[model samples]
Target: MKRLQQLIRYSTFALGLILACSFISERNQAGAVERPWKVRAYIQKHDFLAEALRQETGIPKAIIYAVAGLESDWGRSELAKNANNHFGIKSKPEWRGLEYCKPTQEYNGQQMVTQNDCFRKYPLIRRSYEDFGDFLMQSERYAILKTLEANDYTGWTDAIQNGGYATDPEYAHKLRGIIWRYQLTKLP
Candidate 1:
């Protein structure tokens, strides 16, 4: 009878542990669910500028939005907040504009390494979007992306990734996912 009581107590403890773990998992999932709403809000706030830039530069608005969204963490990154640099455009030696220096992580073929990098700082968010368009237009490496249809965000993402816009091997995949998940292609 005593052994039976001990077994029941152990089972109760295990059950409580399982319930706690399940609750924690649900909380994490809830945060994931909330992220889409945040991204959507970001898109809504910036879609007009993205569309304007797209019309001016012929770069797809979806590509612009997705790249900015990913690079800037939906405009919540320190670079975006402080520098208005939504595209993560690093400072070049020839850059004659203000720069913000910060520690950033870059994949070094083997692993991500943190390094101090200087990024362009913009007086206005519009300037940041415009500079991103200019960067793509002027870079010979991304010239292939310009020939694709304006609505072909997938092709553009693939070309941008191929053009070494990011070190992440899954950069195109993530951009495509963001475009699809948020229906960015439908934006004007």
Candidate 2:
């Protein structure tokens, strides 16, 4: 009788552990499923503005959307939420606007490094979008993007990565993946 009781106790403990592990696994899988939905929702919320900015600035809407989505983590990053900086536009010395400081990681050719960086802040989300458009239009490094056709998202991504817009070596590939995954290339 004593051995049976011990066996039952061990079995119950094992069963509880198994149940807890199963719950954790299910939650993780649910998170994976929910992420694409979040990206889709982010795209839905900002697609019209992306199209408008493209029309006004001559940048491809797909490129704008994919870049913003990737940079901002589907509008869920701290910079996007706190500063409305969807494109991760860092604050330059010449920037006279409000700034938000946060820790960020950048690839420095050798490896990734973390540093506290200041980023531009905007009062409205629209201002963020407008500033991103103006940023591309005014930067000589990105001038090549203007020559690409409006729907050439892959070309724009390559140009942006080549122009040193991001330190990530896989920046262009990641942008292309996002553009393709979300069908952003269909945007006008």
Candidate 3:
């Protein structure tokens, strides 16, 4: 009888451990929605950024898609949901010297509400793309990018990751993978 009781106790403990591990695994994988990089989304949502990218960086549409895909998986990123904060610009609370203003329904495009908060909104993806480009141009962090501006999307990406835009350990690797996957360097 003692041996049987011990066996049952061990079995229950093992079952509980398995259950806990399964729960954790499921939680970790849950809510991971993949957003495919689409040119149209960029055209509609980030048109302003898109144009600026072309004009300033001379990078084509395809390259932008590849870069954004690796960065935020085409803007379906978890962080993107909050304040449309792609490119992971950290809050500069010290820059609170900037003015604050309320947004109106008609006030479209990216606007800085407070020194620390910026909202990027667009009626279409193209607008979003262009606005994103302009965003980097205007931001203090990427100001150096403007000066060294060339069509070096690869270099731009590396600089962005190195500049502490994101804490992701594999950010640069993932970005490179996406860039290679789509061969954005060749697309006109």
Candidate 4:
């Protein structure tokens, strides 16, 4: 009986070691350094954008990060493809007042064709935030967000959902998950 118990203990130790090694190997394979580097670069590029939005709208930087992280994966989203509109906001009829770009698109799997679509661009990151605020403020559907302008992420989430910003049912939960996972509410 003593030998059997010893054998069980050794097996448990080996299993634990294997599990730990597997976890570490998976983390390394996920490109850990690249993940942090991408997030750091995103903040460096758009810190001014967050500041500008804060000045105009009183939204917290953490909330902004949460939104950006979920939408664009710290600006590494495949949707950008290159043009830098990381939020996946498609140009629609409501954006008529904003500037339009002749972006190429393949409709229903056809050849690329030019379409007049609204996109926000800025010579500076500050201007991008200013334009984003303007876009949000101008939309009647987004009026619910106005009440959430000051440091309320739950409110912001509900407002965005109410405004039809995303149909993905998990968007808010995912954003909240990222916010907590990164502890984005904490100081840098």
Candidate 5:
């Protein structure tokens, strides 16, 4: 009886350890994709940040939130999780700030391919948002976005893609879909 009890306790401890390890790894790796609820929760949780950033930068709040969803897969990417680089922004020669390099997927004309790239690293989510504002604001390519009405999310989407923010041909459509799905326009 004593031997049987010891064996049962050992099995339980091993099982618990396996479960705990798996949970941590999944969270550290897949994040929202592993837990479906995290995507939705991430969007909702950051709406206010998007709104404030919009007021500060003149980028539409909906566009900011939608881009966060489309760019980072609602904060599931490793950069988003580890570095708070929600926009998939890259390091530029002009930028002398901190950065994080990671593997990422991008459309290479015909198909998607993975490449290791360097992206801006922020210590906090808000810094990422603020930097996103500065990023676009400082770029001449994105200057056209300023002429469009602040609430014109569709136009903003087009401008972002046309400005070469993303290589994916469907970037605008995907961002629009994210906004519609989340009903982000309803946010103040």
Candidate 6:
């Protein structure tokens, strides 16, 4: 009986270790750096483009910056590097542009689900930022964001999550963490 309990405990520990390693490995494989400063530098380098988009579209650059950082690791991920898709905006059936498909993890209300999703592809990095702003501006699901005050990164973050821009329940929190961690709100 003692041996049976020991076996069960060992099995549980092994399963948990495996799952944790897989999760971290996948995140690392996505090209995110382990250091926070790298993300800040990356965001700074790309802020010019996101700032331009903000000016043209009235979307907060901070939100754009954080989402792009989280989704594509500031343009280092395979999807972003190969296809210029930094925002991870999936392709809809109506999409007529190029597409890139990859395995991604999404939340389906109750749990994390991994599936191959088709992402919108752009020919240029600037185009990707432009399309990302346009997506939030034109979609009714994100209409509420347009009404929020400019520079309200928190509000923008919340609305983006509630609008289903991402499936993770903690999507907004993660965005906010990055924004706060790197002082992204300091951006003018």
lDDT of each: 0.89, 0.87, 0.55, 0.64, 0.83, 0.87
The TM-score of predicted model 6 comes to 0.78
Q: Pairing residues by index, what is the TM-score of model 2?
A: 0.78
Clashing pairs in 6: none
lDDT (10s digit) by residue, model 1, range 1-188: 99999999999999999999999789867753334777878877998898888889899888998899999999999999999999999998989999999999888784888999999999999999999999998899999977999877778999999998988888899999988877777665
- Candidate 3: misplaced stretches above 4 Å? 1-52, 56-63, 75-119, 147-153
Q: Model 5, 131-164: lDDT tens per residue?
A: 8898888889999887899778888999899998
- In the range 1-188, model 3's lDDT, one tens digit per residue, is 99999999999999999999898778658833233446447435765665567777554554466556654556776545544544433335433322223222221233323233344433344444555565555668766665554556667767666765555555556666766665555443
Listed per model in order, the count of residue pairs whose N, CA or C atoms clash below 3 Å is 0, 0, 31, 0, 0, 0
Top lDDT prediction, candidate number:
1
Q: Clashing residue pairs, candidate 4?
A: none
Residue 117, model 6, lDDT: 92
Which scores greater on TM-score, model 4 or model 6? 6
Off by over 4 Å in 4: 1-35, 78-81, 96-128
- Evaluate model 1: give its TM-score: 0.78
- How do all models score by TM-score? 0.78, 0.78, 0.45, 0.60, 0.75, 0.78
Better of 5 and 6 by TM-score: 6
lDDT by residue (tens digit), candidate 6, 1-188: 99999999999999999999999899878854454676767776888998899889888767888899999987789999988999999999978999999899999996999999999999999889989988999999999987999878788899999999999999999999988776666676
RMSD of each: 6.5, 6.8, 12.1, 8.3, 9.7, 11.4
Off by over 4 Å in 2: 1-35
Score residue 87 of candidate 2 by CA lDDT: 96
